[model samples]
Target chain A: MSNDNEKDWPLWEVFIQSKRGLDHKHVGSLHAADAGMAIENARDVYTRRGEGNSIWVVKAEHVHASNPDDAESFYDPADDKVYRHPTFYTMPEGAKYI
Target chain B: MELNEALFQFCLRRGDDTHVLSHRLGEWCGHGPVLEEDMALTNRALDLLGQARNYLQYAGQVEGKGRSEDDLAYLRNERGYVNCKLVEQPNGDYAHTIAKCFLFDAWHLPFLKAQLDSKDEQLAAIAGKAVKEATYHLRHSSEWMVRFGDGTEESHQRAQQALHDLWTFTGELFETDEVYTTLQQAGIVPDLGPIKEAFDRTVNEVLAEATLKRPEDEFMASGGRKGQHTEHLGHMLGEMQFLQRAHPGAQW
Candidate 1:
């Protein structure tokens, strides 16, 4: 009997860009009965003041993640890769606006 | 009256409509059945309040008055307010509030669209900006109307009852009053007669989509634009004006 109530809508993660030049940032999650409702809910929750120019809502279950144990192998290798760093490049004598 | 006077009156009407409706909608903050809906109602309220501020400030400037937007909002008596009676009604429940919004938002969105090209530059500018906000309001309310109307048996029954109950107040939105008539003569505002046609089309389409019937054969309520109001307005004003009434001119 409670299954009808317990089978709540899926949770969706909302991402919004506050303005035209801004990057989309994750705001919050909302439970919606469907994808369309999720998008509408995201708008209501995130864009009340003309804050967002764009929105993206994805079901939380669809997100893929790497194991924390693989962090060293996955991300540590890039940390010491100084050749991949742009810091080695010397600035010109006078870069006015840089 | 001069053009500025007409524009001032026009903006006051517009501002009062938004401000009162926003205050009414704001009552739903945190009280909505679901969290998402709670946020939706509050968000719409904020949008309307913001628009009201803009319009009221413009109205003050046009009137060449020293009063700020808050003064116009808080100091005015009930008779001075020009909002349609539909907005001043109580938010009885979720379905009731949604039904009220569905009716008003349907009219407001299209009406604002017509104002985008108003002869008055300021009015046109504000309308151009507000049209987008009103579009979302209409969409959000319309969607809920469909969902609730076609949802569970109890939800459907409640939603239909809400529509019928609030149907009388809807006519006030389209009533062409002296202010509107004078403004139309000056080309400062759109003729609401045409706007009503569009409003009816949109409302009927939404009602059809929701499988709800159009309410029939009831005498429509009027007089909000003419300063007469329902008994509910007094209670609403008493609460809304408490802060200002208690501490006159006091501000943080």
Candidate 2:
């Protein structure tokens, strides 16, 4: 599709980390033609006051997110896997705090 | 010579330029073409006004006459101010405003970067913090300039016309005077020639990217730094100083 029309700019998801040692959390989505333009649009929209140390922009179409209806099936499986829990095992003697 | 004497004048000039331009930009607060751009312009304007407050407060202290930033800002006469002419022009349209900002911010970023090495500690500190802000201002303004200039035929015509209308006022930014010469000799200010060269390169690059030609052989407007200004400044000062002039020593 030609993205020259006013409504043609594809939506891009914006993820921003406000500082170092922080995870990039999804802030919002804005429309842009490319990743570079998406980053600029995100900066203009989200980070007005030196707020973010890093930014990640992904085309909204490319995000492989599970539907809400599958939340139980996708997430509940890990909850019952108690062997994956670290609390089940005791620490070795004189082991550093974990 | 006393440092405060020169510093007071320098800070007022800096403060006035930012204050006037910020107030002008604030007019676009609710009226930007898009919501993102609306926020962008206002955010930049707020940043400029914040910088103005810092510099003006410093100017008050350097004057050492018990005046506040508001007094320095709102009590000054037209001849006593020293802001450049480009900032006081009316915000005719979005393209015009963006073009004016691109022109000024292009000069300001390098100017502030050089001032980081100033002999005056306070000026250097102010310039150091301001350069970071100025870098973003240049980026935002240049992005709009390029977009509008290359977007559509109507946008292209408007942006190019704005550039031509504002180009005359740009020469005053590089026009030097005795204060600049004295400061430069004393290592307190950067040489204008090099700053002008860098400004030219950056502006030309952006214009080329926008597919717009730079205006040529125009009669350059001058004398803003020396207190001469266009008629627009009178109207601006009238609005800006009305409260202070009406209620002398009024506090909020």
Candidate 3:
């Protein structure tokens, strides 16, 4: 439950990196008065269960996301490009991580 | 007091400090000004609760009794608790809660840090783990203190009022008697002098950044170390221990 008074605070997008070498995946969003608070709130909200070792919080308004309405034009063309698949490459022996 | 008895009392004091404060923070579970804050407060509560369990478990061992952690926590009467009075003060408002937490955390972090070198291995281990949690707890509370003190007209007034109201309780954090003397003489605990200095430094720094004045200790409250507590502890314990009292040895 959120109070009407808290709505005035800016919204921030939270990202959590589960390990040292991992990327910080988008976890969720929360309201904070500033960047420092956003990071702290992200730690509290997203990492309470040892979910992450590091966190990044950016203002939600600052993210430039592709328009959802343009999804067909922006992404659908890639579906038919089977030649772009890397699966056709022959695998080298003992290529562990790959 | 004998060494064992002094150690038992010392452990109980540390345990009770975290336990009572955890219960108080739990009160904010559903009532924080915002949902993120609600979760944040409860997270701190759980961290303190975990530390309380460890301390109480060690305390039970030091007492040479067969009592478990639950027994030490729920079986004790109000006077048996040795937490400082600051932990039991009512959460008046957001500002008041922040003030109480800021003052306690400022003292607590240094106290745990000094404990890291305790001759008692178990205590040193507990303090080692607790220091990490207390560090973040201080950061969280101090951040809120700055925000509340410097944010707006209303917040500034309330923040200042909270500092005044909670100032008296701050003195109890450094009050020492036989329990401390016994432990310090044994090298089981560090001197309170340096801890007090660190507390003063933290408070002064945070308050300066917040643009708030520090309150003077005109009339200091004490006696929590001797199992003396305000009327509030009884009321709080009444609710916290009701289940254990009503059903002895009850378990899931």
Candidate 4:
């Protein structure tokens, strides 16, 4: 019954960790009935080519993001702040651990 | 039977099981209920095909007749195949397909795990790799079984019907003959007793969780291991082997 229709399930955001000591990166999204099925769907859809050793899936609905409508006022102030960038300072020669 | 012949038969049985089931699952290429399911089923089919090639290649080598994997796979006729009948059964509905896959995966996982301890190095290695694939396969199928059997009324009825219809064919999975007995005696293969126990435990656990009743094992069918099969195998082979049979040495 759950698989009777694609719309019956909710979309899940998939994150895959390619190897050890790596952060899980958002790959794509797929539909599944629950977290278990979402993890499995993520594995099938994302890890088929040995792309990842670990997977994390969150329901798309649970992933909150800033509204684009507030982008200009909420983010544009940082555009002209050149001092925030480390490029303004010159690095010493042979400074390997910068 | 001679030792070489028994070993060949043993490999062929396992090979044919995966080969035929892969073909059956492949038939769902563009036909799954959803896009995700389509890919998932095809993925399982590919896994089975990989295992099939390994077993079949080993079978050819064991035969020592210079037959390659492709030759044994593409040239085999209906009677030449030794897969159990359960793998050859038609994929009826979604419920039927899940039932077929679940039943087979339950037996397949443990069987391959036992093969990991095989006295023969080749078989042991193959089993080592195959056990991993079969583990996920069993999980997927068993999850689907729970979904179908515990889902809506319609799904419950369909799953029940499919299980009842397919139960009889399961008996042959544990049945043994001289070929298997010989291999078992030589320590090349494990005894069926423990494998059957594992199969039963998994089946009972899954069925209970799914809220589905176990069908009575009665009038069990046999002979697929001996190359005797239902009419289905012939029709399936006609389509599966058509290209190979029609044009000799055809290649991409």
Report the lDDT tens digits of candidate 4 across residue range B1-252: 898899999999999999999999999999987777888899999999999999999999999999988899889999999999999999999999999999999999989999999999999999999899999999999999999999999999999999999999999999989998989999999988998999999999999999999999888999999899989999999999899999978999
By DockQ thresholds, what CAPRI class is model 4?
Answer: acceptable
Writing each residue's lDDT as its tens digit, candidate 3 over B1-252 gives 798899999889989999999999999999998888999999999999999999999998888779899999999998889889999988889999999999999999999999999999999999999999999999999998999888889999999999999999999888888888999999999999999999999999999999999997799999888788889999999999999999988899
Note the Cα lDDT for every prediction shown: 0.86, 0.86, 0.93, 0.93
Categorize the docking of model 1.
acceptable
RMSD of 4: 2.6
User: Per-residue lDDT for B67 in model 2?
Assistant: 91
- The recovered share of true contacts, given per candidate in order, is 0.81, 0.50, 0.94, 0.44
Whichever of 2 and 3 has more DockQ, that candidate is 3
Off by over 4 Å in 1: A1-7, A17-25, A48-51, A69-98, B1-6
Instruction: Determine which window of 10 residues in candidate 1 chain B has minimal summed lDDT.
Output: B1-10
Tens-place lDDT per residue, model 3, A1-98, is 44576557899999999998878899999999899999999999999888999999999999998999999999999999999989899999887546
DockQ for each model: 0.48, 0.34, 0.75, 0.47
Rank by DockQ, descending? Answer: 3, 1, 4, 2
Among all candidates shown, the one with the greatest TM-score:
3
Write the residue-wise lDDT of candidate 4 on A1-98 in tens digits.
Answer: 34555448888999999988878999999988899988988888788999999999999999999999999999999999989989977899987635
List candidate 4 stretches off by more than 4 Å: A1-7, A88-98
Give candidate 1's root-mean-square deviation (CA, Å).
Answer: 3.5
Per-residue lDDT value at B63 in model 2: 84
**TM-score against truth, every candidate:** 0.87, 0.87, 0.96, 0.95
